[model samples]
Target: MGVTLFHHVGGILVVFSLFQIFFTPHCDAGNILVYPLDGSHWINMKILLEELHTRGHNITIIRASSSWYIPEKSPLYTSITVEMGKDVKDFFDEFIQEQLKVQREGLSLIAFFKLTKKFMSFLHVGHTLWCDTAARIFENPKLLKSLMDSQYNLVLTDPGIGPGVVIAKYLKLPLVLNVRWITSGEGHFVLAPSPLSYIPVIPGPGLTDKMNFIQRIRNIFSYSIILFQQNFVLAPIYNAMCDKYIEGGCDIVSLLQDADIWLFRSDFVFEFPRPTMPNVVYIGGFQCKPAQPLPANLEEFVKSAGEHGVIIMTLGTLVNALPEEIVEEIAHVFAEMPQKVIWKHRGKRPSTLGNNTLIVDWMPQKDLLGHPQIKVFVAHGGTNGVQEAICYGVPVLGIPLFFDQYDNLLRLQERGAAKIIQLHEVSGHTFQRGIKDVLHNDSYRHNMQRLSHLHKDQPVPPMDQATFWVEYVMRHKGAPHLRTEAYRMPWYSYYCLDVLFFLMTVVTMLLFSVFAIFRCLFCKKTKTKCKQN
Candidate 1:
């Protein structure tokens, strides 16, 4: 009788386990609303969307009508298009042109100021445009009600723009950020404790984790410039939106801090060690995959390099072509290299193009990077490309054009996996030297291979890890336990300034009291002596 009872209980347990395995996935499907920033940021967001869709989550994307990369129609997610009159693509194109012109003029005080002012103006205008669009979103009662009725499990957004954060708050949904760069600067500056002693602030002249006294001071000053942009420039614009839309007033930083998770797009292999929050999940290289078979012609060209291997070059999505003179110089460098080169350039073909070089308007960058025949990558140091290089173990010769590219290159340079030839410093000699150093030295490739190994060694792949956390938030409603309540505190309290003031005030009072007691005793003794006299 006892043996029969035990077998019956075991059979019931087996049935329960099977039910969970088959049915839990469908039950876990959630409705997620995404507000993604346009341009390169949308690329990362789409990757996450694909994973979630595969896991049976329903996704809805909010996109601008003029969004550069996001498609209005896709099987991955349904998009709600906002009618935006502005086309920031031209603005970005103009800025890049101006930046190139200024940078090529070489370093100067006037040139520096001109470029900085232009960059800041671009930032402000971008924020303002989003702010206006967010207001229009709030103003549409029908749209607002539709969103309310949909009852999304959470808002998945890139906090590089403020609209998503604002919308998340208004809807009172759980927030998860797909982030590396936030509105002001690196995501950590706002989300975690950044000690300037070691953690260098970006957009300054390149400094590393190791710094002297002068460099530390420069870091603080650079950080102050970031604060100026955040508080003086961006806050007022977003704060206005908050006051109008949110039931109670909210701030951008507070909304960001309240997020349940941050699917951070970098790891220690590519990023310097720094303080990170519990909720910040490192999903660097999540978008990377094994190389697919290349096109017949591309494969034929790659194989033609023989044992020397091929070098691939591309300037990323924004900068389609370099200045003609720079392009000609780069072509000249390729002419000297024994290895064949494939360059993605939209400009007129260089007169110096060698028989060993092929120039195309596009290349399958990730697939090419994964190819064993590829020796070195000549790229703009964008986050996606940098991480991809690490994923594929390809050493880089970076020609950083503008905005965060130099900083990204600096991280790899520090690790000895890549070399940067800044725009102002790029010439045939420098370009050729950088390429040859990476290709022949062997150490650059070895170091990058080590990084690739470390990056791939994780138990859960970055993409799976990112998706698990997104679902975790959906299941739990929000991961408030992982989030820090420090954001809720006043600035003085958060920094312990009030406690310091109180302790100092008490010590000062005690010292004054001791002096008074001594002074009173001395006065009485002097009076007695005078009376005796």
Candidate 2:
């Protein structure tokens, strides 16, 4: 009886031990390597990395020396910086200059298209240079061998960098894309569903899910243009980089198709309704938080304004400085406003600077936007800034310059949360009136607050959702089951274009055959009639 009792206790102990061994943490102290292309990408990635680090995952970041922010070396996170031999920040500055030049000249209908084509070409060149510079890191034999042996659980890539896909493939690691932009330029079709019928290919032309006949035609044309550029232009640039850096050619399309997960910096609140696959996750306001206390000077400034409130103006990191005349015109407008203004000016202070307005090279944008006295936010309409405004329930007066800024602002306008003044259209009266309208109107505030509530009222915080999914992908070893079957289907078959063509071809053949037979019978009958005659 004693032996039987002891045996039963031993069996229970063994079962408990096995359970503990098999069911530990989902992540299992896994190593995660992240490649954030630039400051913009890094800003979106920063909060996600913090969450992952706190969760006991080993985090490694490969940063460019020109990266705006570099986290300190610690046990939780480490970084490897690649010297690009040029200030990458200059790229943004140059791009902005070109945009300002065009805005100044007022783009002609033909010149606008030509300018767009030129800018896209220039962007490709920059991407090539970026990828080539990044490839230098892999040239180090020891580092490459160490990374290969480490067997990282996941490779978090910013698809903005063309070479990131190739590097992940070379390491033989599972790929998870961190796309920071709303625009789907970077081979995203592989993992996400881009039904062009309803989805606006670009930002404007008054498009929504319920598009009119003309709008649908415009959507198709926009998608066709984008597809042509991606396939004919972007694909070759990426493929060339792959051949130079990777052993087995990592095609961009193939890499995206094999990606385990995609964390988009977007949300349903901002985007029109569109189809999404299992592997795609939206964490739009993941990095955003409620306003923090302002600095003493800024606090006092807002306090002094009293009932008048304050306005915040910024063009984000990319365009820290604006054209001189535009700044002067803005300064003049701010001088006349009843509210106190805080302008983030990187260039020389405008001579029209007012006592009511303060000029700074940088400002705590999110915190300022969250302030109660803050009435309006005049910005360039970057996704992060727009989302931050939405998070804080701040009404925007957008002065969109380029890229998706125009589209982002257009969407905000559609939602009645913002007003837009194009770069070329920014005059003293226009800028001032735009600000006055948003501040005076109750509708903008109401819509923004509603969207803010919707954005915040989520089943789980976006940060946790992102972290859980990242770990989930790692735990499951690539999460192949989560990927959509669409990736496996060819482009022709995916859209059913091939099937439609085949059916059409068969019907045409049958009709022709019938016509031929009818003609033959008619000829025979005519001959018979002639013979009878």
Candidate 3:
């Protein structure tokens, strides 16, 4: 009886200790400054920031007013608008129009090479415009002085902008990076243990972990191009900005190398095999929550559909320049389907609007996906949208546009959870068939359900995991021990190229020396034989 009682008591103590470690809230709160990347990135991060605010941390977010407008005084957190000078934003607006025009042309079976060139041009223009905007922000003497005076305990930023690094350096704070997409920048490659061998780099042309020799070659080529664009084309502009703004002449590369933590908006199920270090955290689909009840009209519409269910189509915030012809084609297909469709169209209504389809400028996508009546999601394969679909166990019919969207959709198709219809090949019949295939095929549903289960089966919710790590970093003063030593290694040393080259040289010299000795011996022996003869 005594022994049993002792074991039981020990078990209880162990349980309590585990509970305390996992469930205990942090007593020490911090003042954190967050740098926002655009509207979509902000949407991805909003929930976690709110959770941190509720946990007693004072959060100051610097974002564009056009994307997220918070009142001057809010009880939850603070919002500081980063003013995008009038002409800059307008110029980007025009650039977006030109990009859309190119995409529209691409849909008419334009050559893939032409489309790629246009997309690259668009990316270059965007980076240049963004750099200019960032410079403007850093040049504001008042904003810079105020930010420096804020005395923040930590700084969190998206790697999409170089200004964040400059700001952090100027403020003399430990930096944490959050990437809102699967496609990574140079910082990720430099700071994390993510290598390109198995990890398909962003702008990947549909390469996967199960690549053959040819595919690996293609991946290497694509990775090289991406690196060139980031380091040569983009990094110089950022380095210039950093030098002009920061007092100590900060190197953007060094700043990223020393970053405290990396929060990735990705998960293992959606990504290929890759190495990751401790400081890296995957928080994919963290923004998804239990669905709120639908609005009255939407609820009624969904209910009216009955057994046919409904389909949801959204192309994300940045993809607003959809062509009219494609819209009409989609509408014609919707007209024939039994399912009612909710299309999130930001532009003028399609002339072919069917009775079975409803068009709205915006909708609560996650909530709709959670609804039992929502059967299929027609999306452009953006990371957030695809993750949400996977989270809700709703199969996707992906119409990928550009950048990582194609790669993301390819992964989904590989997993048997989705079907991808290239925009250039999309017609009424193709779009309808794609939707029907995902909907009627039992495999898609089963695969997506399995994915959802795997996603939810985590030790802690993603939000809590993010919150714990954020506060842990705060309590421990930046968690430097978690960072990998690879971050500090030189490029050549990091990949061991120098070591490999030295080995090759030694082996070559040894082979040459052996060959020379053998040849000399053969010649001397032949000479002796000739003399004897």
Question: What lDDT does candidate 2 reach at residue 14?
Answer: 99
The candidate scoring highest on lDDT is 1
lDDT of each: 0.90, 0.80, 0.77
Candidate 2 wrong stretches, greater than 4 Å: 1-25, 71-76, 182-190, 203-207, 210-218, 244-248, 501-533
Writing each residue's lDDT as its tens digit, candidate 1 over 76-126 gives: 999899988698787789999998887788869888777878888898888
Q: Write the per-residue lDDT of candidate 3 for residues 1-533, one digit (tens) a residue.
A: 99999999999999999999888975577899987676576677677778888888988877654443334456767877655544334545555566456655564435555555555565555556556666766778898788778878888887776567667777778878777432224335665566556767676668777777787788888877776666766667767777777775756667776777777788887876676778888888888899999999999999989998999999888766477888888888888889999999887787888899989888989999999999899999988898898899999999887667888888889999999987767888898889889889989989998999999998888777788777777877787898777756777997899999999999999999999999999999999999999
Cα RMSDs of all predictions? 4.5, 6.7, 5.0
- Stretch of 10 with least lDDT, candidate 2: 181-190
**Better lDDT candidate (1, 3):** 1
The runs of at least 3 residues in candidate 1 whose Cα sits more than 4 Å from the true structure, single-residue gaps closed, are 1-27
The best-first sequence of candidates by lDDT reads 1, 2, 3
Instruction: Write down the lDDT that model 1 would get.
Output: 0.90
64 Cα displacement, candidate 2 (Å)? 2.0
TM-score on alpha carbons, each prediction: 0.94, 0.87, 0.86
Score candidate 2 by TM-score against the native: 0.87
Give the top-scoring candidate (TM-score): 1
Model 3 stretches with alpha carbons more than 4 Å out: 1-27, 64-75, 86-125, 136-142, 180-188, 193-197, 500-533
Q: Put down candidate 2 lDDT per residue, 1-533, tens digits, no spaces.
A: 99999999999999999997788555677899887766667777777787788878888887776656765465657877777766656666676788788976887877678766876676666776776676787788887887788779989878876566677888888888877442226243445676767777653344667778888898887777666766776778777867877786666777776788888788989887777777888888888876899999999998999999999988887776788888898999889878999988888889998899998887988899888999899889988999999999999999888777888888889999999988888888888788889999999999999989999999988877788788888888788888777756777998899999999999999999999999999999999999999
Among all windows of ten consecutive residues in candidate 1, which has the lowest summed lDDT?
Answer: 20-29
